[model samples]
Target: MFDWNDIRFFLELCRKGRLTEVAKALKVDHTTVSRRILSLEKQLDAKLFESTTRGYVLTQAGERLLPHAEAMESASATIQDHVGGENRNLTGVVRLGVPEGFGSQFLSKDMPSFQALHPEIELEFVANDRFVSLSKREADLSITLERPRSGRLISKKLTDYSLRLYASRDYLAKHPPIKTVEDLKDHNFISYIDELVPDPQMLYLSEFVASPNVTLKSSSIVFQFQATVAGAGISIMHCFVADEHPDLVCLLPEEIEVNRTFWLNTPEDIHDLARIKAVTQFLTELVDRQKKKLLGVLE
Candidate 1:
């Protein structure tokens, strides 16, 4: 018979992808994590992971075992919360994946308030430009630019936000005046490297300009914002972020508005968990409170 406790190590390893990280998270040594995994694999007579230079990659057996193990973990948590008389005080780690700009510039400021309300819930923000896989369990929940077409997931349209072309006062002063979209061709522009953009919705430059005088390119929206702030060149930026900086000026807002939606997604299995529900509620309320700001309405 396999030990139920061994599933904890297995899940941790699957999420972290590194023995040292799993060890640190569980307060155990790396060897102990490895030993538990090996023991579990031996008992089942199935290879759970294959060691590689990148770390341990889950084998077919591991993939098959994941959902069952996660169900067990969820059940254990539910029992602990209800039976231990701690249902009122929600406690667990919720890893949220989000786009870098929204996470850092928009949500980061509001996170402390949520933390204050749910003091026991640990929040991990996996803020980056790439798509986080719900199927692979990269995060407990994610805020995606596009609603997923298919997955064993629960998703909703969180909010609709706008982006517009912006340049610093210093940059506009140093270059030609952009009275119309035609004038944009004369100016140097900062934009994403074509190959690196994770989503086509991010290719805002192409929507208006056919041949842009591209000077700077980066995969990071934060870096592009910083560069635009430093007077590098005009670049498309989220209105919520750019509008906060008095130095940044929106150019041709009526002609160049780009609207996009953020979808909140969670694995269907754990969507009803107290911790996940709390964070989802927090996010829903957060976006709702800032609806005007997100839609680029300044009032």
Candidate 2:
């Protein structure tokens, strides 16, 4: 007989790679994860992992146990979803990772409604520019700029959004006349730091300016938006966000348009879990409802 609880820890450890990360994800102490892993190994009488300076490396036994444990996880999620009848009372934490602009400007504004409907379901939101790892359980759900290319994950195209050059009303008033993309070279630009850019797709300035005179760089798109709004410099700003701020002026909407799509992604193992399913549905509906805004079809 195996303790399903122990298997839970095992699954987390295999996914996370580090005991500390596993402990954080499972809401347990690192020692507890170590104890559970040891106990499971003792019961099975096999070394499941090789502890090294790098991290835990799964042994043959652990690798063999992985698929079985994953099947059990899927079975458990199916059972819960079926028993819950897709009810709103479904309870558990669902961590969502999203790009800073979407999370801060868009999703956070609408999340209050989700919270009102699903009071029992706790939300852990991570708004970042970096890619959150579903395989590592860093986030249960994620909104990514690009579709995930690998892993046991599921994805859906959320919506397409446009970006264009923007500057503060005051900045444009004080700067030289803008007639073409060539004029952008003389203006102060704001952009993401090259090394800190989480994905290459985020490096959008080169498309407009061959070598921009970037006066400021930030990891958060929200910050860049704010700075641009404060007359700091021009930036390639998301239409959905920049359009809302009356102080910012869109430049060359026809000639400098940049289109990008957001993708919703989740690990296959927990995709059918009641809470996850509920959130995914909510997200799909929300994006659909706001498709006009997302695609810059509205104002």
Off by over 4 Å in 2: 18-30, 84-88
User: Candidate 1, residue 104: CA error in Å?
Assistant: 0.8
Q: Which lDDT tens digits does candidate 2 get at residues 1-299?
A: 76788999998888878999899978989999999999999988989998888888899999998888878877887787777566457898899999989988888888889988788899998987677987766789999998988988999998888888899999999999788988888999999989989989888989878989999999889889889999999999888898888998888777898899999999987888878988999989998898878777754
Total clashes in model 1, counting residue pairs 3 or more apart in sequence or in different chains: 0
Q: Which candidate achieves the best TM-score against the true structure?
A: 1
Going through the candidates in order, what is the number of backbone clashes in each? Answer: 0, 0
Local distance difference test values of all predictions, in order:
0.91, 0.88
lDDT of 1 by residue, 18-69 (tens): 9999999889999999999999999999999988899888999999999899
Query: Number of the top candidate by lDDT?
Result: 1
TM match of model 2 to true structure: 0.91
Instruction: Quote model 1's TM-score.
Output: 0.91
TM-score of every prediction relative to native: 0.91, 0.91
Name the lDDT of candidate 2: 0.88
Model 1: clashing residue pairs? none
